[model samples]
Target: MRIPESFFVIYQPKYTVPCVFDLNERGTFPNHPSVTGTWGFRVLADTDLKASVQFAHLVHRPGKDPQTGKAYEWMVEETSIDLDDQLTLDSAAVEKKITDSEIRSALMDAFNEWHDNFVPMKKKKVDIEELKQKLGNVVDECKERIRKELVRKNQHWVSSNIPRRIHDFKYGLYNHVKERLYQEYQSNGGEDSEPNLLKKIALFNRVLDNFDHEDLMKPDGTVWRNEDEIWQCWIGFAGSEDEAYRICRTMDAVFKDLELDEVG
Candidate 1:
């Protein structure tokens, strides 16, 4: 006969654990002799980290008791696995996989829809006539300045014996416009984001005036990583106090149900 204590037995429990592991934190895990070389240390194979954790669980598993007929049951926690099965993955590779993958992009799209529903972007009306007038004035000013600069340069170069340069470095142009453009950017609000029409024009002009012709060809794309972000999970069974409690409860219920079946 099943003991009455079976009724108090627990079966399963839910827990929230941080699934994200920063590659920088890889040093926290002990060095395994099986893995060799400096290259291995660069990226954290979440698999290895997880294996160690499971190894700990294995080490702590209960031994058989002389008095007891059955060994203590281990309640394994439910877990999810990471997307990649690679033996080793660096941060750059991981980011590329996540950011470049069509599937992951879909995830972002779905998330974007959810986020939009949660908080929609506000639409604001603009005074078209006023905006046009301001733009016209800005264009007129820019053109006038450029013409004067060009005329002065031509006169200066003609009088000098030095050869005319192929490249026109717009240092003076940028220097003159940067302060006004920055002010416009500030007045447009949103600080780093949401530049107004004038601000956008001014910024583009400033970059054009200041940056070398070759500068635009330089790469600007960069990946932003969040350490707390769960890159992936290694799904497995692990035991917790709550899981033990739940397992006890389920054991009790199962005993009662099965016992009733036998009695009938």
Candidate 2:
């Protein structure tokens, strides 16, 4: 039988993040004229706790490099995976036989994944109400405490703090994406040879500065003129397989941070 979809959490995220500080050296982002970019994530499996990611690459567009006849550098490819019964069972002997470095790396990631994604044949049901009671909170106090953590569902972005709330969210999300990518890169046999992190950022910033187009300016009609007044954004179009893999990982991290499972 197909592994129950319930065993895997589902999410769809379309993010437009702009940070106050720049990760690239030339300082600001979204600076280029045709400044197109790409990024994506992959599925990492651990025994029974298998991971399958489905995400859109918000990076580059499809076209050929006019001179080289090569495809535009789309960061990652679209991908999916369905695990077999033996794989889901976390068979030790089978894992030993699987010597492909990428699969092994993914398995390591899955085994050490966050508690929410790990599944065997059952689940642990933590008792929240009992803990609330033990913490000296009566029903009314508990109600009030819960209310404080709730987000404004019907909030008007133009008239409320929703934009600011989203701003903070993307801030954390960006860091989550970058850090997860770096870790995955190092894990999957990426060697630090002639790597220049600052130079990459500087080149990215140049692309942003010269990006005189309307694509990156979408998500909201807000223009990125005043740096001090509003946060700066990091936008991408075409992404790669590793990028896709890490994208899912980063997104899961963001969602888990909300502790939404326990709250809403």
Cα lDDT computed for each candidate against the true fold: 0.27, 0.33
Q: Which stretches of candidate 1 lie over 4 Å from their true place?
A: 1-124, 157-264
Candidate 1 C-alpha lDDT tens digits along 1-264: 111210111111121222222122212222221222111101111212111001001112343434544553331121221323211123344344343354344434443343233222324434445534543444444334433443343333222321211112124333334444444434433144322322333322332231344332212222212211101000001022233233334334444555575689
Clashes of 2: 38
lDDT computed for candidate 2: 0.33
The TM-score measured for candidate 1 stands at: 0.15
- Candidate 2: lDDT of 142? 30
Each model's TM-score, in the order given?
A: 0.15, 0.22
* Candidate 1 lowest-lDDT run of ten: 229-238
- Evaluated at residue 95, the lDDT of candidate 2 is 47
Tens digits of per-residue lDDT for model 2, 1-264: 022222322221222332111123222223221223232222333223344443222224455655556654332233344434322323353245444456546544543362234323223553434432322223233323322322121112222433444455446544544544445445554343212222222222332442455443422343433331111122121012243333335345544654564486
The CA lDDT at 60 in model 1 is 23
